[model samples]
Target: MTGAFDGLKVVVHVFGKVHDAGDGQGMLCRLDLEGLELVATQHRVEAGASPRTVRFPLRTTEISYGGTDDGKLVLKTPEHILYAERDELEPELKRLGLVSLDHVLSRERQLLGGRRRKGLAVWVAVLAGCIALAFGALWLADWAVARAVDLTPAPWEVQLGQAVLDGQTWDEVTDPEVIEPVGKITERLMAEAGEHPYDFRFKVVRDPQVNAFALPGGGVVIYTGLLENADTPEELAGVLGHEVQHVLWRHSLRGLYDRLKWHVLVAMVLGDISGAQELLLAQAAGLMQLSYGRGMEREADRRGVELLVRAKIDPQGLHDFFGKLSEQEGTPESLTLLSTHPSSRERQEYLKELIEENSGARYQPLDVDWEGLQEKLKGGAGIER
Candidate 1:
């Protein structure tokens, strides 16, 4: 049977132990609802079982349960539910705040929803602002780094080359006999190269790898393997001349500047100098992995040929060296050079053509002490040569 209130929707705030007939358990609750109360006359199921349906009627805006001294359930009309005992009803109704229940629930829902929306909007705006600042910071950092540093690969590269050489001096493998000869060759080349803005230095490393490289600080390093392969002084001079051109052009600095520009941009965005430093170090390491571009390689080669011609040395020495290196194209040692500076065949052909055009007529060749250098390199006990 339908009880006192059946069809009305009610917002509830329950308190104390309310039996959930469906769930088969007693629940502590605080229910604030108008026109709804638990049905009293419904058949009581087992003590802990949930009722299929609540059968009581609600006649008032407020109610209280379990208020009787004898444990009998009572329904109060239109406003309140009171049990048969006055002593039981007085304490529970007062504690439940039945007088102001309806007003509190209505105000709570209104204020809570408005505050939630406002807080969500504030968080969204903050997130958007952070994103914009990140991009702006990166842009400013990039601009600043571009203005502050010059990364062109030039004479400074030679300094690094020298440093690498100097570092080798403390090593046990450095042969004292060749030091003087290497020094003499470097001095002569520097004098012939003429004065420029960058401070240049040359190094002869003890490595067997046939390679030479320039650093950003005017340092040029030539490996011993390359030196041993040169049958004539002119061939060695050609290699040195080409490396010197790389230093003069500041190619190392240019590569560094390009990579560092992006790093500085990131640093600016983050407002951290440490990030910039890390980026620079990483870029420096990458510099070793770089090879001169094709145009740059050709320019250096042409310049070197010009230097040898002006120095009264035969340019054929360069072509011969390139020819030897071209033969080892598939080998592991030669792969390093090819990987960085591709077009070995093309370069060799170009050098051969230049040698034909410039030195087809009979010309005197400077005598190079090749046998003595080779003997010295063999680790002989005496320095007779």
Candidate 2:
């Protein structure tokens, strides 16, 4: 029948459970808004049982819905109870215009959206700052290392090179007969190269690597394999000059710069810990094996030619040594000398030009018995590569 419920919309849904004085089970319920009543119908809780229906009239009781302490919605009167989880009932209650769920939901959405945007902005700024910090660290490290290398005293460099040499086992030449020629050549070359930081210790090691390298200070190591390959004293002189230039320019120290990362380099330069010498010298074993980059090698070649010119030796000896080796049966890397001192036809051409421009009379034959040195090393039990 059309009663007072006719004027407003009726909301219908099922409440999970309902109880009244009659103690009947819950039914699907409808809120008859115009009639101001809650109707619960069709309770068939057990099999083969007739269903019961109930009507809850608003006017008879104080009708209210609220959340209990455990967050459940309790719509109750003194005579009856309607139960549901708060989330289930709140929407229906709002739809019935009995609550302001819309205002709360919209406000929560606005708050969450604002928080998300702020958090995203913070993370973006953090990432940008990290990137900038990384670049800045790298720049500072480079500047620090360059300054440290520059500030390194000559005596310390020599000490560092000696420490490096002492750390390793090289077949150090002791025979004055063989050492005399090497000593004379280095003396003459140093005289031409002028006064410098290094005391310039030259060693003939019984290594078959066909290599010659400069240590951090003034230690120059020449392998017997390299001596075996020398066709003339001039060739030996040419190559020796190149190695000397490496020591003179402190290219070994600079090459070590590339690896001395920002933090480590800063600690080294800033701390300048004498105790750190062991840590640094330990790396000498590794650094001794490091190959010079193109720029350093080129500087060595150009400066080597200058020393050769000043020593009154043929500059072409160095050129010829490299050119002839390039035509040999191995790649440049096969020869540790070529590997450490990178060479190309371009380098040869540069040497050729320098030699041509500074060409002069050939001087003393490095004043050594080269044939005897080669013959001595032939039967020598040289060190392994």
Q: After TM-score superposition, what is the CA distance of residue 221 in candidate 1 from its true location, in Å? A: 1.4
How much is 384 displaced in model 1, in angstroms? 20
lDDT: worst 10-residue window of model 2: 61-70
Compose the digit string of candidate 1's lDDT tens values, residues 225-293.
776777777777777777778777666655555566666665655666555645554556566666777
The list of candidate 2 runs beyond 4 A from truth reads: 1-138, 268-279, 329-334, 360-364, 381-385
Q: TM-scores for all candidates?
A: 0.51, 0.61
Residue-level lDDT tens digits of model 2 in 147-262: 66676777877887888777777777566656777777777788898888677788888767778878877888887778788788788788889989988888887767656645
Q: On a 0 to 100 scale, what is the lDDT of residue 377 in model 2?
A: 70
RMSD, every candidate, angstroms: 14.4, 10.5
**Model 1: how far residue 31 lies from native, Å:** 60
